[model samples]
Target: MQVIDADTVARATPFERLVPALRELFASGAEVPPRQVLTLADPAGGAAVTSLVMSAWDPGRYYAVKVINIAPGNAERGLPGLHASVLLHDAITGVPLALMDGDAITTRRTAAASALAASWLAPADAREMLVVGAGRVAALLPAAYRAVRPIERVTVWARRPEAAEVLASRWRSDGFAVTVATDLANAARHALIVSCATLATAPVVRGAWLAPGSHLDLIGSFTPAMREADDACFRGASVWVDTEEALVKAGELLAPMASGAWRSADLRGTLAQLARGEVHGRSAADERTVFKSVGTALEDLAAAMLVQAAAG
Candidate 1:
């Protein structure tokens, strides 16, 4: 079996390469079973941690399972909140083929997925963006969005002002007009694209602040208990998700799903359907659009396949 590390994954599947791979995978489709998100209790009565298992296969070709560890309290220990690994296998023989850095795969694929969805959903001339949160995933959004759109200006907002400034300075050195924003809603109103990746349990982006023709990409909320956008945000826009099954597990969609404020009937369609032309994207320039992603197993499989292909 082969082993792939974070550096190798970074070198192999840069967003430019990975985004197109993700696009192709979603457009074509894959057999992805339901993803498992388990929260195991801590014996010491501490904050519980989460484990995610996502499995998918291309049938005759390969099968893969990605295991992710979500430790929110790790920040207090000066560690990353998320760590992951992937095991790839031969579909027919069921033999182990590779062990990979699933966190790397996740970070790249997630940014790529956002960029892929943005290509279809965002307006053609979107030049400015607002990226909420200054974590690992947040660092990748600028370059990823740039791959699909002509984004020259980017604003980063985080709970800690220093973190936002640090992230902004790094991107600025890369020649992007990146800045730290004090007001999220104000930043949301001005940008052509608003990409959110915070771990907030409450709404960070409100509907009232969004301007016309803006595209909102929600990437943070994973569980039904976490949300980054208000119900008004969905009510004001034509909503879409990475997958319906994934959305069912996300709190952003669940709140409205329960209240009937935003139901299946109001959904534009999943990214796969949108990719295949089964559903349309951005009918008008003035249309407010929201793309909420809780991540997907198909994306993990697609990224793993791309990593192997790149190595060969």
Candidate 2:
């Protein structure tokens, strides 16, 4: 197995390549099997284990699997909260083709997916962006926004004010106007709102703060217990998702469904439909839109394929 580090993966995978690859994978009718997640906790020992396995298949030849292990206590020691590995295999022969670091793959592919959704869902003239959460996704949102829209400024918000300020300071040095907002509502007032947090309860962004012509990307919630956007947010906007099945498992959507404000059938359409021209996206410049992503395995497969190609 060839060990690929985060820097090498970052250099090899660009949004230009990964987005188009994902579009092709969607166009070719690829399917990601249900992801498997396992969690273990021992209260007295203060140790927990969380593992995730995601896999997807292309038409005839290839399949990929990404396995991740996450433990929460590492952050106190200045280590990543999660560590992962990805494996690519030939479908017919079941031969392992490549092994790579999954942490970089996760961040890049996720940001690329959000960018792809924004490109198709947001108004063509979007310029300002608001990113919530100061972790990996917040750092990536600016780059992803620039790839899809002409982002002129970015505002960041996090639970820890210092973390948000630090992220804003770095972005300002990079030539973009960046600000750190103490309030989530203020941070979410921009043309685009991107949320990436792992908090298990309560909504970080309220629905009323979203302006017309805003595009909201809720990326943090994956399980049935976590949420970033409130039910009112869904009630006030048109919702689109990367896939229908994935959305069903997404906490951001499931919460609203339980409240009766949203129905499973209320989903506007899939990203595939928009990409294929089957559904109209952002019908008017002032329409409110939201894209809730649960993160798909197909995205990892698509991005991994691109990274391997670029490395060649």
Candidate 3:
């Protein structure tokens, strides 16, 4: 069996290509069961450690499982909070095919999924993008969105000013008109697409600040305690998700529903339905849309298939 790392994964499935592959994967669908999370109590009395197991399979091709570790306290040690490994096996015979870097595949596929949704929902005339949070996902999101839209400028916002500045600098060197944003409200209002990937428990992106015709892409906040947008984000906007089940996993949707601020019926549709044209997306050029995603194992499986095929 082959062991694949980040660089190899990159060569296998670039974002632009992965976006189309993700579209096909979501459109066709797969067996995406609920993820399993195992919690380990810290012996040192620190924060509990979390290990997530995500698995999915397409009947004839292959099945894959991802083991992801989340150690939040590691940020204090200047380490990544998320890391993972994934295994892909032949479905019919159960033969191991490859071991892949889960973090790398997860990050890229997450961005591609966002881009895939944006292709269907984002304004056709979108020219600017505001990416909240300067984490690993933030660095790659712009390019993915730009692939489908005409984004001319990119702005990055973070809790730490230096982090935003550093992220902006890296993108600017790549010939992108990148800027560090201090005023998130102003940045969000002017942009056609506002993509937020943050761990903030409280709302960082206000619904009132969003401009008309803008699409809000919520990528982070998977747990019930975490949320990135306020209640107003869904007040009247057409809300959508990667999957209907995502609402159960993402606090961004669950928190409001728990407080009676949102309703289950408010969700217009899932990406799959939209892709299949079973439900319409963005009826008007000036309408508001929101796409919320809590990571799914099927996306990882589809990504692995695309990457594995490319590698072969």
TM-score of each: 0.93, 0.91, 0.95
lDDT of 1 by residue, 1-312 (tens): 999999998888888888888878888878988778799788987668999889999879889999988887888889988889999888999998889999898898899889988988999998889999998899999999989999899999999999999999999987799778998878888987989999899998888888888899999998889999888888868988999875668899998778777877788888899888899989998999999998888888888998888877
Query: What's the residue-level lDDT of 175 in candidate 2?
Result: 76
- Residue-level lDDT of model 3, residues 64-113, one tens digit each, is 99999999888888988888998999988999999999888998999988
Provide the lDDT at 41 for model 2.
82
Error of 2 at 147 (Å): 1.1
Tens-digit lDDT string for candidate 2 (7-94): 8888887777777777777777676778888887857676687989899877567788999988887787688888898897777888
Question: Candidate 3 regions off by >4 Å?
Answer: 42-47, 72-79
Q: Which pairs clash in the backbone of model 1?
A: none
TM-score of 1: 0.93
Order by lDDT, highest first = 1, 3, 2
TM-score of 3: 0.95
In terms of lDDT, the poorest run of 10 residues in model 2 is: 191-200
Query: Which segments of candidate 2 are over 4 A away from where they belong?
Result: 39-48, 72-79, 190-200
